[model samples]
Target chain A: MDNSVKLYLPTDAAHIQTLKPNTVVQIYGTLYTARDQAHKRIAQALKNGESLPFDLHTAAIYYCGPTPAPRGKAIGSCGPTTSGRMDAYTPLLIEHGLRVMIGKGVRNAQTVESIRSHGAVYLTAIGGAAALYQSRVTACELIAYPDLGCEAVCKLTVENFPAVVSVV
Target chain B: MKIVDSNKIRSDVAKLITECLITPDRAVTNALRRIDTDSELEAAAAALIVENNDIAERERAYCCQDTGQAVFFVKLGDGVQCVGLRDALDDAVRQAYAAARKSVADPLTRLNTRDNTPAVIETELVSGDTLEITYLAKGAGSENMSKLYMLTPADGVDGIVRSVVDAVERGGRNACPPLVVGVGIGGVTETACTLSKRALLRPVGVLNERADVAQLEKLLLAKINALGIGVAALGGRVTALAVNIEVAPTHIGMLPVAVNLQCHSLRHGTVKY
Candidate 1:
């Protein structure tokens, strides 16, 4: 019982409510990563029309702030952070061409409307499966906001990255 | 004289706390392993979260660098009377947090905030002259989702399962998984919740001795995992790593069940004196 939906960017808000509870989907291609602090930066960037570190078109943004990497590991416990915190920034990101949004928990009404309007979907990752999520990440490079500690922007490469397109 | 220099014991307790935070417990370890073999919905949810560990560690490093919330559950023997126990324990927490900040490389944790603060100190009087302490450092994600339902005797077992499943489904990905579903059945509503939290102290996969209660655990596990709320609610087969049921006989008319959700980063330790 799996269905596919389009990806939402960091600020996209549509299709959040339509997401039936428990729908599974596989995530493909590149996406931006951000959590509470990073979202604020992304939102501020939007307000000023400043170029983001990564292109927003067709990008899927996952809300997460992972643990530090061990000696040789790419990342640690890189699971989805809460989605509710990102609701405020979603609509704006969707407007900018973010297709798929990856996170956990329910989205607010505005976010759901934006997802439906923008043709973007929301996906959830296990909240605390850090070691497991460590496996899917192929590579990671710091993109911006190194000062924010774990909350910094980092570009991650994922392969066979399995995610359920939670929205219809 | 003094009851075994409770200060020294507190220091030792602090050391244990430090160790527990840096390591993973059996419950959390099992939860991670279960995600691997979970069903499709469960797997996907777990897989992504397993991926999120990197971020969690980073957050752990940056936030609450002090790791200051060092509270303990102490059981003092009837033969002993430790003066300044509370003040000493508080000093240990403060000292440990200070040491953690100076020596520990990780970031400061969020302490003294809503749902995160006032480190819980539960003390019980027991036999002997020694003191036993249990250290629990609960994180926010899972703790936020914990709930207690006051059920009537009529609600029975079915009611317990429904309430728990509903909590899990509604909790979604916020609680973090595969969660240790601690079902505290019986006692008053608040005590039921405490029982549930205490149940979490049991090792992963351990079942209650009572046949009927054990059966209820199995049924509830099946229903919850079936909710397809799999890992991080990302969807998976193993929604909860293990359901631990701890029950005490309740009032004739009341059947209270408290569901305490412990996140995948279950950091807790116990010490017996």
Candidate 2:
């Protein structure tokens, strides 16, 4: 439990593999936010032979749906959603070069195997720590799927975002 | 007779929702404080959860982003008269959600209601003139894992225990670990399910009145924790914080058991007027 690992987004597969399970890490740089609906859309697009909304290389996806920001705050109370819901679309994203995912809950066996095989790692954030996590978000902007409301895809700039490597 | 005003009730209800969201219940917070973790991973995770609650309170933010569906349990007094009770509660929910800027969407269409409304209201007419309302903002993660089973009489208490453990095992990380399991035994299918949910309204760590029922709760909790589900479904010593059981008389031939899993956030509160 060193708890000192600092990872930059778009990290390489080799780097991800070196991280052990339960290793606490502070992630820096850009992290894309997507939940069940956005994942479905991406999976469907790939099925139809279309490009994804953002390049997956070295990208990290966070399963979250934040409340509306009151006024001057960078974001509202933001925390991880259940990752199990995204188990169906995860392997596909990993195969397409997804290197990191931040969420809570257990992943299905297939998703775990995909993470290990595809050089991806799944990280768990403290599930209910919405305010603490939101405090780390420096900025947030809607990236895609505006119609999904809180479930929309957004790019979040975070500093020292806390998470534990669950599977690598 | 207590003549309650609709407007007053609406405002009070709205404020109650906000209060419950911003502040974690004392009983739940105390339970988290008492969690003794076996592994460093669990310890770190537990620390973060405790810190999160403090931050949420100081910053007036939600403990979890998924503010959850609005569920209300109301006990109306016979001598209390408030016109348009349902509409007032609905209006309160709408206003509260808008004020908090939380999301509530249509289940099928995924369309945001803009304001959370049409709260699930369960009402009971009691004896006194005081109106008691309990609010539970149930997150979808745990709510999705809730189950109901209609067992034959032969299943007995052992059967009930096995089914409860099975539900927790299958729920695993999906429902969030270190959970509060609400068990409802007896009654028919729907009654069993409602009883299970109502069971959750009880304060965490409190036991049933009947000695046998209390013993059953202890047994179920110990067995569930033995599964080693831990916090956030990672490996640890504690899987469930408490198991609260509520039973209702039912047909002799049927044994209906419903298990409702609640996450660590346990956002619920009560206000009496």
The candidate that achieves the highest TM-score relative to the unseen native structure: 2
Least accurate stretch of 10 residues (summed lDDT) in model 2 chain B? B98-107
Candidate 2 on B1-273: residue-level lDDT in tens?
Answer: 998888888899889889888887767666667778768777777777788888889888888887888999999999999898899989989888885544667779877777777788998899989998889998888988889988989999989999999999998577766788999998889788888888988887789999999999999999999898787777788788889999999898999999999988888888888
Q: What ranges in model 1 sit over 4 Å off? A: A1-62, A65-79, A92-100, A105-110, A121-123, A130-168, B27-71, B82-117, B249-253
* lDDT for position B182 in model 1: 86
Q: How well is each residue in B204-248 modelled by candidate 1, as lDDT tens digits? A: 877888898888888888888777656555556666777888888
User: What are the RMSD figures for all models against the true structure?
Assistant: 6.9, 1.6
Per-prediction DockQ comes to 0.23, 0.72
Query: What DockQ results for candidate 2?
Result: 0.72
Docking class of 1: incorrect
> How many clashes in candidate 2?
1
Per-residue C-alpha lDDT of model 2 across residues A1-168, encoded as one tens digit per residue = 344699887778778878988788998899899998899999998888898778888578999999888789989998899998999999998877787899988889999999888778899987778889999999999989988878889999998888988888
